[model samples]
Target: MTDLTGLTIAEARDGLAKKEFTATELTTSYIKAIDSADELNAFITKTPEKALEMAAASDARLSKGEGGALEGIPLGIKDLYCTKGVGAYACSHILDGFKPEYESTVTQNLWDAGAVMLGKLNMDEFAMGSANETSYFGPVKNPWRAKGESVDRVPGGSSGGSAAAVAARLCAAATASDTGGSIRQPAAFTGTVGIKPTYGRCSRWGMVAFASSLDQAGPIARTVRDAAIMLKSMASVDAKDTTSVNLPVPDYEAALTGNIKGMKIGIPKEYRVDGMPEEVEANWQQGINWLKEAGAEIVEISLPMTKYALPAYYIVAPAEASSNLARYDGVKYGLRVNGDDIIDMYEKTRAAGFGSEVKRRILIGTYVLSAGYYDAYYLRAQKIRTLIKQDFDKAFETVDTILTPATPSAAFELNKVVTDPVEMYLNDIFTVTVNMAGLPGITVPAGQNDKGLPLGLQLIGKAFDEETLFRTAGVLEQAAGIMDAPAKWW
Candidate 1:
């Protein structure tokens, strides 16, 4: 049989339904792919035994014609999600060897839908950093490369493993989280599809916290339809998570009609940041042209609050991160470093456990939340976040959706941006507004740059309106027709 590993979720599901291959065969194919692709460092843990066992059951169910939506699909779980008994470190030293007794709600939902877990994928330490360099497990290398270049480039942050794995075909899809572009940025870099549903669409129970308000769970998949199918299972209202929206999850895959006729798509002028690469700008214009050809009405709109998104995000996200990460004291279940006294122990353990980037954010977070500066920094950032949301709200009043370049440039070399924290933070410039506004946004691989690296276009939709984003992204995916896989080197 042709390489089953390369087939998308929809193709795999259809193949399984037709009995062309058993679930065990599909799972084994992915295992072999994972073994061969280890150089990418995509997975931190491999659950092959568990995956095969589940696949066998799925085979039996398929024989009985009773398979679930994702029956027999093998997937990678981002290390941030707690997978009962599997090591659930958020790629941070502080949570070393920590395994939760319960599975994250999102992963549990995937399991219920018959998706088999291949293993835990690597990510940025505590979901910090923009280039995946902060990962204690080491940075994930992007599967794609610039023309004629051999030096490995970074897969985008936090969800870097998810993007790399999906791009490399190590797994059918991966569960990823977004806090300031973790999902979308990596998707853009790796030329895969990623969507961050509205803030409350997916329950956050059992997922490690990054920034309570901004962190959200989503999927990184090989195609727009795969992402829609994965997200349908991942999203649900949970009594355990108060922030989860209590609404029925729609059939997102069904929403991809590929008929976006007369759709009013807004082109945000503010996204045309100074110093933007010409290739990136050209790619954005190409996306606009593609949509216009598909009968989508292009409209220019101004999001006046765009300039404040990055600074405000830095303040609010880190401030909340500080509060969430405070639980990793030496007294907890993870690593501990001893000191002369309890206070000394807390200081020593934290100082030893967290990475430099984590330390920097924590210090900044603590400073903003400090009694004297709370109003001046954290409070003001919160107000700016409100305005950012308002800008999108007003724009949506006249447009069905908004489009922008997913990233300012293609993937950069590892440690290239890390040296300057500000430059690294700019990676999320085009994406953080979606999180701040609590709206759904998707990144579709639109075109390739002069160097042959992929560049994606972003689509922002109304709150809890992921269906529209999926539909629009599907149209762009068809119009762009740029689904070429990276040349194999690993």
Candidate 2:
């Protein structure tokens, strides 16, 4: 029998249906893989006992010839999603020992579809950093290494662990969230597929609040089809979350026709950022050529508001972060440090709980939302955000979807970029605009750099039009033919 740990979600699904492998066997294989993969620091929590229990239930259902869409599939949940009875910290000390009484709407939806939980994956502290280095649990190492280089590269952030786990085949797929480039950038770094559906596509009910307006939940998987399958189970309308769109979810897997004939793909002029690595540019051109050959008409389009996206995002995200994070004061749950007074306790708890990057963003958020600066900073940034969305609205009128480099460069060695905060933030340059516009964006591994590290191409799609992304990404995935796994060095 093939290694159960090595199967993709789609492959595992078919295998389980054929009765070639029991869910217990599959679950045990993943448990062993995760137990041995601690060096990668991808998982923050492990639920081996719970996983086996769920797997047993799935096997009974499969034996009865009845199973849900994700029956018997094991998946990693990003720490941000609150799993009832499971520690759901956002990789921050502030939420220490905090377990939700109810499961997150997204995770609950996955569970309803019969997906077994492997464990909680690590992520940025409060989902604030671009590199996984900012995670309180420590950085997640990218499974991919540069050619002959011993230095450990980061798997990208805030959803770094989700990407690393999928790339390492630790899980068939994992749930991930995108506030800025959290989902796509990490997928680009780890040679995995990640999609951030349009804002409101997935219910945000139990997802730990980051920037309320920008946070969205999605999936990271080894292949586009697997991601599509996961998304189908993960997205739903929820009465608990007013932001969740009440639209019928599509069968995203069926949409992967691997045909993009006559599809209009736009290449945004502004995405050609200055100082983009040569390898990134070449990979992008290669993607364009592949799509062109497959019959997608490449059109040049302009989104001049791209330059202001980062600045506006920094402002708006932090402002919301300031407001949403205020709930973490020592009053309710989590860590609490005793101080001389209530005010002293509040200051002490936050200071002790939040990491440096989290503190930095909170300060920025507070400053921007302060009485005197609200009009000059927060309001203006909101106005710019509207303009950024308008830019996409205009482009989509002429083009079906937009194509760009997922990141400026391939994954870099961890800690190398963290010293300069701005440099670290720059990693999201090509990705943040999609979040700002509240549009769907996906990262598909396209090619490898000269260093042998993976690089991906970004596909920006119309709102609620993920089928087009799956179709186009499937075409690119076939053209690239990159299904090799990283060498097992860990």
> After superposition on all CA atoms, what RMSD does each candidate show versus the true structure?
0.8, 0.8
Per-residue C-alpha lDDT of model 1 across residues 200-316, encoded as one tens digit per residue: 999999999999899999999989999999999999999999999999999999999999999999999999999999999999999999999999999999999999999999999
Per-residue lDDT for 27-131 in model 2, tens only? Answer: 999999999999999999999999999999999999998899999999999999999999999999999999999999999999889899999999999899888
Report every candidate's CA lDDT.
0.94, 0.93
Show where candidate 2 strays beyond 4 Å: none
Question: Candidate 2, TM-score vs. the true structure?
Answer: 0.99
Q: Which residue pairs collide, candidate 1?
A: none
Using alpha carbons, what is the TM-score of model 1?
Answer: 0.99
